[model samples]
Target: MPGKHVRFSRNTHFQSPPTPALSFSSISPASSYAPLTPPVIPNNYLPGPSPYTIGYAPIPKAPTIRVHPVLEYSSHQNVDFDILNHPSSITKNRRLLSSLVLSEPATSTPLRSMVITCPHLPWIITVYPQSGSHITVYDVFYEIYRSLHKSITSSDFASLPSDSARRASTRAYEQRYSRHRSSRHRDEEKRSGMLRIDFLMGMTRFAGLSPTGRGPDVWQLNIR
Candidate 1:
């Protein structure tokens, strides 16, 4: 047993290798570096033309509509939109509304006066150029309107007074007449005794005596 071959154990004769220490000064920041990027526009964003021109613009050279009410309800004047003096007739977004009357000439004579029985109701009058073709309701009304326009724009044009003015004038005239009548009646009362002297005398002659003793005469004839 003493002569057995001696075997050297590796662990008993070996030493542990030394480990390197970590140092904070030798650390590098290569992993922390980042690139900057521009902001992203949303997908739903929409662009448009100038928003200033989206509003309404005034129409050029449009005739000023002057609505003069001659009836009780001028707003009710309704006519087909097709029956106007359209020089360069183009359909427009805006329309004119009014209650007016255009005068029509009588069948036998040119009477351009609007003959209305009741001026209190609403009505409209439109003017149209003369047409060589057959007459329609529109034609008639248009012709009437032309006549009225001509008459209105002429030097001899005179509109009738309104109801209020007419009523006031009539009342004044009646009052004056009443005052005249009352004065005339008072004068008649004053002259009544003088006018009856002659008639009484004539009657007294037959009845035997007159209270004033005067003869009957034309100036003193008893009218009452």
Candidate 2:
């Protein structure tokens, strides 16, 4: 065999130049002078209306409320006695009283009345309107009978002594020996000027100031 032809093939591949390492310190001061730009917002994105803008105002709306019928004066006077017996009706009575006093006026007559029965016995309280926004409780009497039509004294009067007189008798009894009790009695005497009864329910201020609520025999109406 002829001597094998020895041939050596030359390796021909292009070699790229080595890249330079980049750093903040390595960057020139002049090259850093270029401004940093904000990130580009996507094409589909949009800013919403501002809260302070008039165009974004809240829609006006009338409240959807079940307006309960105004409790008429007739219905009010004819209150069930069972409601007075039950403690749950206190809240209802409060609400009704407030609504009647504030929203619905006693327009028909010069005087208007409603009854709320005491737990055990029937007591009639007479209220008189004073010059100031105050009510003076003239008298409170215990009733003998539950009669609505007949006069308070004729059929129902039981002649109970006034609260003030009872209070005075108690105070006098207490101040017999104690000097402190005597001083307190004097203070109480000064404080016992007028029985200013103020009934505040919700926003209603039950001051004896209305003409319809004034006048004599206002307490004749059966509350219970």
Candidate 3:
């Protein structure tokens, strides 16, 4: 009976079993995964037109130019005669001087004296008693026309030794003939036939006149 009492003692507490270690080797190679989905865009949304598009851009317009009408004259003689009766007193004096220089005998002592006494003609004239009696007004005019042609079209400034002299001569020539070249001057000259002769002395200054009336010549008035 004692032996049976000693063997009857028992435990009341319960114990859990040990857990297995986790590793990649434990995972299945043929395991199924869900496929990735893309984000959704609105159907109404659209991109703007690119600046690089050629036909889509507007073309620029060309600039408009305004041109003035050129004035026309009847004849060259009408134009030439107009300078004599110009409204401008200065122009009249200059034209008168030119006329006198061209028309009058270059060797006439009295004419030379008159030109000398007149404050306008600065060039000194040594009248050699030789008369331009044979040279008529028509001849002088013809010579003038020839000189004008040479002055206008001829590029012969080779006679002038210095550049400064050439330039000065060129400028003087331009100033003298500028009126003849202009359409307005031509029109005015043509209309000035009825105007009175009011020759104002010392009203204008003539440039490029040689002091001795010898050299540095542009147009030769070969009336002598």
Candidate 4:
């Protein structure tokens, strides 16, 4: 390319854009900005009192045990209680026996079974009334008392239910046989001490008026 004119400087220095100067103003005395310090939680410092109110739920208490009522029932028929006087007089059929005092009323129809057990006797007298008759008839069952040699105090005996009467009877039995006490007998008594009566159907059968089994004609009373 012809006729091109070019101009050059003798200073020989690289040209660059000039940077603008920066200015800083003095911090205001009234300004809130200050050096960072740890957060100041009132009432809280090293080994100092805490601000939070800590608490816990209360613990639950155990349930109280239930005590059963005393047995107070009356026998209407004047049957001879002595086994010697009447051998076959234990069962009372059509006996109009009614409970004088009951914790709960007879919820269903009247159905009662009487069991007469004595501490001194070796036999249990059970009177089952014939349906619709309620007269006295007797049956003697072999009394198989668990040989437990533990005597309960009169105080304890009075508070306990008739179901616990067996325990008392067993204790009485143990006392009578205490004269011939031996190590073997003591061990056996200790083992049998834990045994208790399974059921106590007072004045009435616990399972009153219900179909008992696979028989159509058979029925039972679910009385507790």
Query: Which stretches in model 4 have alpha-carbon errors above 4 Å?
Result: 1-114, 117-177, 194-224
Q: Best candidate per lDDT, number? A: 4
**Tens digit of lDDT per residue, candidate 2, span 1-224?**
14411111122222212222211111112222345587998989987877784444455543221111222224332222221112113233434323223222222222233332222224444332222222211111111111211122212222224545434433432232122346776454333321111000011111121113323233232222
Against the hidden reference, what TM-scores do the models get? 0.17, 0.18, 0.22, 0.18
- lDDT for residue 158 in candidate 4, whole number 0-100: 41
The residue-level lDDT of candidate 3 at 27 comes to: 16
Q: Residue-wise lDDT of candidate 4 within 15-99, one digit each (tens)?
A: 2122222211222222233455867767754665789997755555322211111121223322222211122222334342222
List ranges where model 1 is wrong by over 4 Å: 1-133, 151-159, 162-224
Cα error of candidate 1 at position 222, Å:
62
**CA lDDT scores, all candidates in order:** 0.24, 0.25, 0.27, 0.29
Q: How far is candidate 2 from the true structure (C-alpha RMSD, Å)?
A: 44.9
Please, what are the lDDT tens digits per residue for candidate 3 over residues 108-186?
Answer: 1112121111222222222221233233222323322222222111223433446664445444433433447777875
Per-candidate clash tally:
3, 1, 1, 30
- Name every residue pair that clashes in candidate 3: 82-189
